[model samples]
Target: MEWRGRRQSSNIEDRRAEGPVGGGFGGSGPGGGFRIPVGSGRGGGLSIGTIIFLVVIYFVFKAMGIDLLQVVSGGQPTPAGYERSAQESSPGEEDTKAFVATVLAETEDTWNGIFKANGETYREPRLVLFRNAIQSACGNASAASGPFYCPADQKVYLDMSFFDELSQRFKASGDFAQAYVVAHEVGHHVQNLLGILPKVNEQRQNMSEAQSNQMSVRTELQADCFAGIWGKYTQQKGLLEQGDLEEALNAATQIGDDTLQRRTQGYVVPESFNHGTSQQRSTWFKRGFDSGQLSACDTFNNPV
Candidate 1:
């Protein structure tokens, strides 16, 4: 991709130096209670009375349907002492940041024009750059979570090191592939703006696990298609080079749930597939790329 010297987004928040900020009660699962450590020091563990008080507080929050653990931990309670890898910083780290900002800017332009054309306003989402782990409205997440857009906060959280993983582990190397990651997350932001995410999430609540997974697959494929729409606009602006489309398509294929499951576990479970198969992912992306229209990207009603 010919993305140098392009306009970079001003909505980026660089928290790479801040490390992990918020601390919360430790837990083993989403509904797990707080873990109060025990030790043999004056400040080591809480008193029995203090523990009882905390238990009461936990129950009170639970009664109100609020997750106190999640609240104290920012969003999701991540493992303790999650730190950045020593190899996370490379010589091209600054360049990668620039490229990310440029790609975000491109998506902003594309979405803004699209929304304006439809007589609606486009709200650009803030993208946070963090090292290791970060707190988000959706939850606390590490780089292992990859890039995600939180509908609660309307922001995209990313750890740049994931690009390295995308290149090395997923074998989806290319500037356009990286750009596709950003665009896909931003596409979720667009879905949120269009109220697609809210509706889907509402419906998913009453669905079975398999039904929910199917709904999730449709939602993700639509985002892939939206990313393809952004790619189309980027190409029109002369920013895309030869093979850029292939890079993104390859990325879509590599990250498909079936492909990832097979690579990691040596088998694919069709019922658990939430992000669609490789063929579906690349096909939807190409569909949007071929016809840069929202009508072409409706994975919900259309047979994706």
Candidate 2:
């Protein structure tokens, strides 16, 4: 991917220095109710008990229509004892950060134009960078959960370390594959903007677990197709290098529910599959790439 020298997004929030495995919910400002400096005296670790307590607090605030996450993220001061010190990034990590920012900028440009063409406005989403763990409006999540977009906060949470895992563990390496990851999460943001997510959630409430999983597969496949739309845009701009598409396709295949399930449990259960199969993921992505039109990316009406 020819991402270098391109525009970098201003939506990145670097919380790497906050703490290792840092997460907390509920609090007005920095010290609203439970203000503790990460990486100071608490050994830079969050206990499971603390996380549960914060979750309880978070739901209480949510019931009252108060966003505790908003208050905590508003830049309140740290506690008296713990101080946040500076942390340095490696040269390679710095490049990765730049690359992610550039990809985010490209997605913003592409989605903005697409939304305007459809008589809608695109609201750009921020990307939050953290290490080990982070607290989101959805809930606290570890790096093992992978990257995700939070509808409540309209932010994408990521740990750059996932890239290493992608290559070393998932066998999906290459810059374009990394870009595909970003695009996929941004696709979720698009669905949220289009009110697709809430509708799907509502429908899922009355569905059986197996039926809900099927809906989830459809939703995920749609996002995959949306990512392919971005891939098409980049290809048209001559930004893709040789083997870039293959890298993305390989990524799509390797992360499929069937592939992961088979690898983990030595068997595949179609009814339990949430995301599409390996073949379906790559095929849907290719469908979107072959035709850059949004109509071609509809996974609901059409068969997978």
Candidate 3:
């Protein structure tokens, strides 16, 4: 949106590889490094060696009952591929990285203002731009896993290639739609700051599988609404172009639980849906954008 010449957020960590991607071998040359597998494709599934390594690590931590999110999200003792760092993104991806940082900075500014007005402090979440695969507080995930926010370490994981897929494969083309995806993940971070995640997790632990899925749907929808809040802010700032709002709406509908399930599995299971229906997602987002108030995004209390 009104992002031209705006100060980009320094909190972002660009982790996109400069070399090979189908192998997750960039930024870290070959030879026994920790790697999260992408699903069902090259550079996706865990090799036997990786499996053994993770098993050993898992047991070591299990003995101490230590949470691994810290290590995963912290990216220290250093995640294998952060060597060159974000500053070293290839010339090709440099623009994309900058744009992502700008988006993050805008979100920070908007949220910071909201928090300040409410007499609260807002801690900005870091955005990790990675490709192929990444290690996250949530676990080792791949670009295929899509963008996600890990509350354990308070960071967002993104793969720039997903934007290509968003426009090309999903046919949801528009800069604003791409922005919506990142904003949605950021919304999850907001939920974490508000204690919604821990509460939801606690409730999920005691709920039936079906009920848990419904809870997840609520969580996803709320994130969508939060994304819409950002969209409203961008609109006010004169950022949206012709059809930009519809592009985001179209993207929201394209990635709904029902749609993804049908595309990936050739079937849809309502009770198994963790994200809401396409209509539900678009509606919640529209509600948030129309209200332009964070208080309106209470999917937990409102019927989906």
User: In angstroms, what RMSD does candidate 3 have relative to the true structure?
Assistant: 9.5
Across 86-154, the per-residue lDDT of candidate 2 in tens digits comes to: 246677878889999999999998999999999999999999887766778877776656788888888
Whole-structure CA lDDT of model 2: 0.79
Give the per-residue lDDT of model 3 (tens digit) for 18-63.
Answer: 4322333223211211111111212366788998897688557745
lDDT of 1 by residue, 127-156 (tens): 988876777776676665667788888888
Best-performing candidate as measured by TM-score: 2
Ten contiguous residues minimizing lDDT sum, candidate 3:
30-39
Clashing pairs in 2: 30-76
TM-score of 3: 0.78
Find the candidate with the highest lDDT and give its number.
Answer: 1
**Cα error of candidate 3 at position 168, Å:** 1.8
**What is the clash count of model 2?**
1
TM-score of 1: 0.78
lDDT of 1: 0.80
Off by over 4 Å in 1: 20-90
What's the lDDT for all of these models?
A: 0.80, 0.79, 0.75
lDDT, residue 171, candidate 1 = 91
